[model samples]
Target: MSAFSAIGDPEEAEEDEFTPGIEPQPTWCPGCGDFAVNNALKKAMANLGKNPDEVLLCTGIGCSGKLNSYFESYGFHTIHGRSLPVARAAKLANPGVEVVAAGGDGDGYGIGGNHFMHTARENHDMTYIVFNNEIFGLTKGQTSPTSPKGHKSKTQPSGSAKDPVRPLSLSLASGASYVARTAAVNPNQAAEIIAEAVEHDGFAHVDFLTQCPTWNKDARQYVPYTDVQDSEDYDFDVTNRQEAGEMMYEVESKLYEGEVLTGRFYKDDRPSYGQEKRSTGEMPEEPLAERYYDEDAEWERCAEQLIDKHT
Candidate 1:
């Protein structure tokens, strides 16, 4: 056989309506919570009818970052705890494209917590979804920022000494325009939540309570947050930010207690980062390219400076 094999047709036949570059199977372990989370993301994109090229899926380091390789759209596997900043920048650079930031709880809450707070307050035009599995799934079951108090792990052999970080209350408090919570087990609800986030104009955030079978607690005992209201007298009106924050604090403060309040916790129509940016700048006449990279001499000078510093 020739070392360089040739294909019969240069172009792919029977083009799929969706992008087909994501052919390689995922590397996540079987029955991983990420499976449902990833599926929900795909369905959300499909529901939005967004072009693959116009959708940027940016992820931070950890198992969640590996999600970039599973998507056919424009994706960036960013450094640990830096996905928000990159996603924010991407949305600012191209307001038309749909930008999403994904990462594990440890990566988002532990290291990237500051970025998360600022992004929410700034109301960056992007959807940020954090996979909350409690423990650090990628680092062989180390205690994460959200790991329940008294929960024993590799790092916390005698149980976690610190309190578990609550994302729902924190996001709402930090001024995230659209805030919500969901569970990976309920794929349909999760998908719907993600779709709603994409439709929203301002900063939308959803912390998915994903179950790590190999690393953490029993998946069955965990109640997956869904939009469905319980038959047993539990009210969940997430329209008001104050009410949402209170409800979130009530449910999320205790470890695995209370009904999982899953729905649009908060939403607002305030001016987005994109709108503010548009108001500040005059519309370009000859396209952004003409203004930015019109001169070859300017590019050469910048490149020479970079080469001198690095080389």
Candidate 2:
């Protein structure tokens, strides 16, 4: 059996399976959108019949970094803006594990923006969920890369001078095979998007809009949202790159205008990084960890074992 399949048993899976046995009460401010993200993630995993052991969640520093502590899974809490690289390594080492990386707007779009871009560009076989609160919530309210151009904060008291990064557009340009945006306020959509991202064979980028009610009271979550797929006004196809790009532009523009549009924007069937490597004969088809069980593994021997064998 594949290492991944050996870890999963969904036939009798329970929703509570993803909940930690020794769960600590969440300390996020009441009504904080981070709550929505946590809830939706668990709901999605449960619906997907994914056991905690079958999944690996990697997170970066910030309020979003606390995710692994709350969720029951094999998790890694990496430094600021480094979750993607760590997640990538874990996936490459164990091709059967389901990988997911998460972080806040600042941690993801700002500090770790380069990693995000390249990970999407390479079409890594994993899911990336970004909690976009538009500001740095953990370090107190501060201007962030996705903060509106004129939004004021501790760092930008006179309002930000630069334009906020358009995340969906950037993801599309960088080569994410699946791109979607969902909001914490709409838990159903968030869960659905996350589930879809997980099932996709290539890189899936979900820009999750999580409101920081205490830090950014005027945050985008203050408004009602419309799902593009459910809305009659939106008629573009999600599979078309040009249509998706245009739609994302409109959504980004509308977010600053007190309007919210959420849902899947783009999807493609391109090969993932692992698939490409394997096709090119650069990586093994089996999980790297499997070699440890075989003492006769000639090329994959441990350093000490190799030294002893040679000597």
Q: Residue by residue across 1-311, what tens digits does model 2's lDDT show?
A: 64454864554556677777776466788888888888888888888888888889999999999988888899999999999999999999887888999999999999899999999999999999999999999999999999999899999999999999999999999999999999987988899999999999999999999888889987756458898898899999889999999999999999998899999999999999999999998888876767766677656447887799899
RMSD of 2: 3.3
Best candidate per TM-score, number? Answer: 2
Clashes of 2: 0
Q: Tell me the tens digit of each residue's lDDT in model 1 across 61-119.
A: 88888887876677888999999998987777556677899999999998999999999
Top candidate (lDDT): 2
Q: Residue 262 lDDT in model 2?
A: 92
Local distance difference test, each candidate:
0.76, 0.90
Please provide TM-scores, in order, for all candidate models, with all chains considered together: 0.82, 0.93
